[model samples]
Target chain A: MIAADGGLGIVATQRAVLTENGPLVLASGAQLPHVEVAYETYGALSPSRDNAVFVCHALTGDAHAAGWHEGARRPGWWDNLIGPGRAVDTDRYFVIAANLLGGCSGTTGPLSIDPATGRPYGADFPALDMADFVSAHRGLLDHLGVDRLHAAVGGSLGGMQVLEWALQEPDRIDRAVLVAASSRLTTENIAFSAVARAAILEDPDFRDGRYFEHGVTPRHGLKVARMMAHITYVSELSLAEKFGHRRDTAGHDKRLAADFEVEHYLQHQGESFLDRFDALSYLHLTRPMDYFDPFGAHQGVVPSTRFELISFDTDWRFPTAHSVRIRDQLAARGAAVEHAELTSPWGHDSFLLEPDGYHDRVRAFLS
Target chain B: MIAADGGLGIVATQRAVLTENGPLVLASGAQLPHVEVAYETYGALSPSRDNAVFVCHALTGDAHAAGWHEGARRPGWWDNLIGPGRAVDTDRYFVIAANLLGGCSGTTGPLSIDPATGRPYGADFPALDMADFVSAHRGLLDHLGVDRLHAAVGGSLGGMQVLEWALQEPDRIDRAVLVAASSRLTTENIAFSAVARAAILEDPDFRDGRYFEHGVTPRHGLKVARMMAHITYVSELSLAEKFGHRRDTAGHDKRLAADFEVEHYLQHQGESFLDRFDALSYLHLTRPMDYFDPFGAHQGVVPSTRFELISFDTDWRFPTAHSVRIRDQLAARGAAVEHAELTSPWGHDSFLLEPDGYHDRVRAFLS
Candidate 1:
């Protein structure tokens, strides 16, 4: 595990997955080479390296999974869910949380330099996929001398990777947990993602995705997309309960003034996210999530793959029905599988929120 | 009733009860003087004038309620629910479906010329409320020499105005039918409306709301707003059943190529709406709906107002819960009220779809 330092926290700089003929060509007609994956490790790696668990992050998630960074008051992204005695149980297993390949956090992504142009990939960053992301995670595992993982757990986009890893390297993954994950991108999902991408692309400061050097960013566009995305992450009942006609939201820092507490919460979530995330990275990640199709490559190849799938009832983004498709397919293949839809008002983001009884199910399933 | 012409059928123009001081000042601060409401009359008017029924339209809805429009093949927005012997039967009762006061469909709205400035009010048009809308409807009724209405039925924003009319002029309207309507804007609802407004305001072509003269309307903003609104109009289950992950929607004339079927539907709906609606009027009508609060205005005032509310099970926008609130409020006020949530997958637009058995309830309630 990397040691915590300064405000930036522990930066893992050891993993270098670069190859001689590297910077592979991407679907967007761009090349990425000299890739580096900065990731964090939790718990101790067993002698067989079979106790390792990989935690895939969502669209806005980072590599940080638990513990506090130096000078930072907050813990990791899944701090509550992946703590000493939490669901992921870092104390009981070695956990790896790596920044995705097309991320702006610590890994090599859009902000990383292109060797050929000697500049950041920016808009030129090659369009990516679940394969590229999982490959990068594999690269990190190779560097760490870990050949296989005991389990892969993820939610939303992270859940996509879990499914990808389970299919891509079936023998390498022992157990897979997919939460509110879809097997393929539906038309509505793709449309929403397209709108989000268009929002950033239309921003004047976007600079055709070169906004970083231009001293301007498509903050407004990013914020709008984030706001839109936030709506899909929650349920109407929760929104009604939280915000319901309370329109006092005036000036900044006023929480209760929300016309609907849900709107205020979403607006705040969107605006705050824009500040920390790179628009291009956001575009890269969301598109892949939309294009994801676990059935495409695998086809009828592995009908009987072991799987455990869970979804929240109120999650409309990737509803419970989506999870059922996976379970059904796996069952058709005669694979060992179980599926459950937890009663939750947290919607698509339920996996992150530590609502009562949710973690209990996670622990029970993983146990 | 003014006869339907040029693709608009069975239209009626009424100078219903006009206030001497009206064209009242709108939210845009422009006064709409000598207001004229273009409506369509269906069924027969009882000798007592107590059988007159008024049906209001949504933001982009037109006055033509039932039957075919001249020069056009399609029927009115609510044609599915209204016809010669439909729910609100034209043969048995005099039905009035009018273009709202602030609408662009042959009514006095932002698109109308401000005689004072010799230009369309555009964005300069003052916002409106259910009060202003009902007043305009009242004016049209007065001109028809109707002292009372048997019932007022409307859905969405139109339903909102129905609620307002029942409360504001309780004596004028004895029965009210609100479908998928809310008494007050939820924060989430207002926030979504705010996002739509911001989109319109952000467009450079909007030109401070004076795009009509410059021939540069904020089509993109309007389209985006409409797209956003469309998401709320349909149910998730309906979307899954209709579009799902199907990629079969591809053709030159079909919208499938744009993205997901849902997105294509939204884009088409939004784009088509911009052609017939005024951007400013969208704002004007939406704001009033957002601020429509029966209890806020007349707390403990009209609790005894008898009302009938109906909602569809799939109408997520104005879900059955919203109707229940109206019923609960009316009941709390000791007003005779009944409400039902029809099992339909049409979402908030079901009021126009006329699901099976819906007309029977309406007939029983009115009779």
Candidate 2:
């Protein structure tokens, strides 16, 4: 493993491969002969391994949750929430962040080679759900020989996994934090995802997710999809504040080029996203999020784990109502639950921004 | 002209071409040698030619405002609110609906042949504004020999034109109805439009707006654009009610297909739009809407015309706050203004959907 610092001191991403044991069964009834999970850890595990905390990431996120990778300009996605004295305080908690099963990082995903065919899985990768992701996390836990976790934390789709952890293995998790995430995807949420997936599929270069073999990426389609999703990720107030009516002088020709500051911002966002994300993984990962329904039939068997649910006031994607619902459901089943709806113009992205208030609340709860 | 009945009696779309009458200058300082406006009319003109009610259509609308075309499945966009006894009644007024200058119907637009090259204008279509649309309407009025209008009414982009008409020719428009619109596009509004336009531009087939010559339409790009715009046109509540978690059994294989009802609806909307609309024309019309700011420098010169501004409470696109701003501005200048923010779940499209309350207000105000 290589270590680097992004102001968070030394941290490194490590890999763990599980093979030669037995085929891992997936939620879709498919099996993978072997799997590799890319994970990063901060601080040291306690002698009993009870102080370890696991952090799951949202779509497009990777195992690099904190600190900088070697030669990388930017730190991990959740660097703001982790570190010496940050919300998830690596000073005290042994934090473990791993790329999801269908992510495009070093994790096993559509880009992974199929041992049977000696080729990349591509569209041949089996469908996965939140349960499958939880199972994969279990594999990482087993590899580390961690019998119990002090806490599990996540936001957005990550939050879904946190809830799933509590539900699927109540005895292994002591605390779970879900931020800006719903118990299940809403119709509007599914609609947005559907459109995003369609955008990628319609790209000619996509070639039924076989673009990797053709040496071409569905850049335009993926960018368009990202642009659409980006709109849902931010609040109207944030967009208005950042790029309201600001015209781009160079685009005054009035053709199809971006004329408004918002257009330029969206274009930049779309283009930058293509550099880090995989189109097939985006399609695969988003499916589980749309199908998430952890508390649907298991309402009567709610876990008694401590729960802290946070939501942003301006988050229309997963509104505060979703958090409130989860809190209420857990409370109804005699679970200790704390819910907070913070005010922020960043909307759903507030989970990754406005760290002061969020960190304070998180720190106080965790402690 | 060919007549057809949509339960409100006979109506037909008529075309008027203006050539050899000098160039029509545009707000962008560009000029067209000739232009064509497609229009439809109902009822008879008063003896004094003073009972003319000119109705402007929104972004996707054309001349067919209140009637059925021969062999068409649906009536004009505003059929519910414009009939013999409905709002803006044709019983006592001559109602006129004209396709904007840069529209797809029978009007001159990007799809029209450039007189200079005998080729379609495509991306070369000059930028237009609400002022240009109003001017084109004026040409139609002049051709019809209508000296003045009893009222000029519109909604959304159409509402922008109504406001512009009142500001540009106050004496010619006695009453103005503006629905679900604002004096200028908000920053968030521009952001949505920017994304929509970028989707079309990113399509490989778009070919820098030269797709018409390549024998291929930017179907994917246009569909993606339409899908994004369709989301803004309706409300979250509406989407939830109509397609909440309504999964498609056929799409269970889950390889970038329509898995939810909303996705299917959006796909249909995008596909149908391609048949009736031109992508370049969409780009042309949306720009003027974003640039419209009639009250920017003329705050003190508010038209003294009687104004009826209607908005929907659920419309996030152009919420009631926008209408309130316009009303306050007009009222501050002592203009006669009636404002109503009706409740609806249809969002911005409420103007065309729920007709009872809207029609009552329009009928009473027009009378």
Best by TM-score: 2
Off by over 4 Å in 2: A1-7, A250-256, B1-6, B250-255, B297-299
Candidate number with greatest DockQ? 2
lDDT of 2: 0.85
Looking at candidate 2, what is the lDDT of residue A102? 80
- Listed in order, each prediction's TM-score against the native is 0.86, 0.96
Across A120-193, the per-residue lDDT of candidate 2 in tens digits comes to 99988998878889888989998988989889999999999999889888878999999999887777788778
**All candidates: DockQ:** 0.26, 0.60
- The CAPRI-style docking tier of model 1 reads acceptable
Highest lDDT: which candidate?
2
lDDT of each: 0.73, 0.85
Tens digits of per-residue lDDT for model 1, A148-251: 78788888888889888887788888788888888886665776665666566665667878898988888766777787777778876677777676655431
Q: Clash pairs of candidate 2?
A: none
What is candidate 2's DockQ? Answer: 0.60
